[model samples]
Target: MEFKFTAEEEKFRVELREFLTKELPDGWTGGGEEEGDDWDFELEMRKKLADKGWLTMAWPEEYGGSGASHMMQLVFAEEMAYQRAPGRDQFGTKMLAPTLMIHGTEEQKREYLPPIARGEVQWCQGYSEPESGSDLASLQTRAVEDGDDFVVNGTKIWTSNAHHADHVMVLTRTDPDAPKHRGISFLLADMKQPGVEVRPIINMANNHSFNMVVFDDVRVPKRNLVGELNRGWYVGATLLDFERSGVEYSAGTKRTLEELIQFCKDNSRNGRRLIDDPKISRKLADLTVKTEISRLISYQIAWMQSAGLVPNKESSMGKSFGTELQQAVARAGMEILGLYGQLEPDSKHSPLQGRIEQSYMMSVSATIAAGTSEIQRNIIATRGLGLPR
Candidate 1:
């Protein structure tokens, strides 16, 4: 099937590119990762996006969004990833807002979503407990009822942006005796409350983006419960689907590939230009074709959403393929850069500011986070192909 952006959509892409050029300062390449320290700058860029209606472009008009089509949303995401801009909040705008729209009460939506669309509040996900990364329903976090609040106690690992989050969307076991999935409830809690502690966990690349969040007597208002009690498994499942949607993967890969190509052309190895080598040329060609396929797969998921159909295993397909391809591209970059690739960004001799080295480190976790590759394949097999365990 043929696929192309509408003329207006293409124009929006051009306008967005121009806007990014004018708004961003010199040499800004951050894509909103590891940004807690410079949160003021991040907030500034996020509000600019909000003003442009780009932060919540796909949200409905009432929620301060332009109600752009999903395809337009796809284009916007692609451009944002390509430019490596720092304004978008995937947690609030991409994950939580959509969940609230579908499962939240009127009061909940009113209180939580507008600030997100305006880029005024920061949110962190409180899933992925110490024992419940992939087996999320098995989380041990307890939320006991007490008057108007549920007193919470647990620790959540790998809680991204928790240090900078103003609030968190957490999954708690409200009924420990019920079946693992049946007893869970989704709750929103203020991060600044008593008994909440955030400890940073710097990755190998030395970026302090992930954290471990500890909650002791963190009281969530009873009214903060999302959807029906003990049914948040389904609600959280919906949010997970949104999380795995993979447009940013291919777009980021495209950026890396472009830079790698340019690097090959501009530099030399073994007394010759790297791009002229037969093996390097072939590798780049293969990655180019695979990147296009990955891009198309992600686009298909967005198209399915636009058609009002849930993507299910299709999301897994895009995520797995696109993420693995990211590793492949980074590996190829290291091969071309050779020993120099090992240098960190701080090293004066490091190539490409050591982005390839960091990409290599970050890509290892890409296949593991959100959900693992093994888990994704299980989903594809059981859901998409109708295979049984």
Candidate 2:
């Protein structure tokens, strides 16, 4: 396999790195978006990225993007993630737009696509429920058509950015009698309505990024529905396909690994630097190899997309292995930090400003979000390996 990036891709990476350096504040580690803090900066950064055409670069030009190649998108995502930049909306730009392009009406596209491409709106995914996370087709959220609207009444848990969302891409069950996978409908619901309630769910890291969003008789216009009615299971799966193809997991882990490497190089234990310890060196080396493998898998996904193919099992491989790699990196950081790894982010003497601690707390959801590791493995087995269901 040819492993080299084209000169143009390399040049874009250089320019992106330069832009980030000039725009970010001194010593910016970009933990604010992860912890759900510093909203104003995030908004400003979002618009800046939109103006620069990096926010939706992979989208087609007719939809307000530059029609960049998927490999270009991979490069962009890697740099943004490695820097921990906060502008890009993964839900809108990455997950929802491509799904809309594939399944939405012209009216739906006109109404929703522009705002997302321009970074004027925030979207939360209403996919996971109290019991329907991994087995998503079994969701119980009901949407009944009444005249011109669908009366949606249900609850979505572990919804990221719901409190700040202007809109939500939701999957609702419309035909209970049908098979679970064939009974659902996808709807674009306005979050500002009175029936929509968002309650906070503070994570163990003391972060409020996740929420429990309750839809009580929420009125969704029929015009907002994407794809055919009772086929939302398929629509939602397409969206998840886009969500799982991201390169962020590997890129973010690469950043974490770099920090851990620097810490080992600078710090000492019993008159010996941590990097000099054979076991520690070996562990880091193993992680390095795994991280590279994850990156190559991501590149393959992008290459496939550039060739105009939809990635089902390929994306699952990327998500499953990349997330596991993320957890592995976090655990390595904690082990290397020893007692100091447990320090809170705000503590004065916390190592790496307690980034490892925060990541360690946050990595618990890496495998669970988007889809579980088991689900990905199942997809690989059934779809990729051609095994029986």
Best by lDDT: 2
Q: Which residue ranges in model 2 land beyond 4 Å of their true spot?
A: 32-35
Pairs of residues at least 3 apart in sequence or in different chains that clash in candidate 2 = none
Cα lDDT tens digits, model 1, 1-389, are 78878999999999999998998877876543344547777889898888878888878888788889888989888998888878778999888888888899989988898899888999999999888988889999999999999999999999999988999999999999999999999999999999999999988888999999999989999999999898889889888888888589899999989899999999987799999999999999999999999999989999888887667798889889989999999999999899999998889999888889989988988898888899999999999999998
What TM-score, computed on C-alpha atoms, does each candidate reach? 0.97, 0.98
Report, for every candidate in turn, its global Cα lDDT versus the true structure: 0.89, 0.91
Q: For candidate 2, lDDT tens digit of each residue in 1-389? A: 66898999999999999999998888988754273487778789899989998888888887788989889989999999999987878899889998998899988888888888898999999998998988899999999999999999999999999988999999999999999999999999999998999999989988889999999999999999899999999999999998999788789999889989999999999999999999999999999999999999898888988887878999999999999998898899999999999998789989999988888888899998999999999999999999998
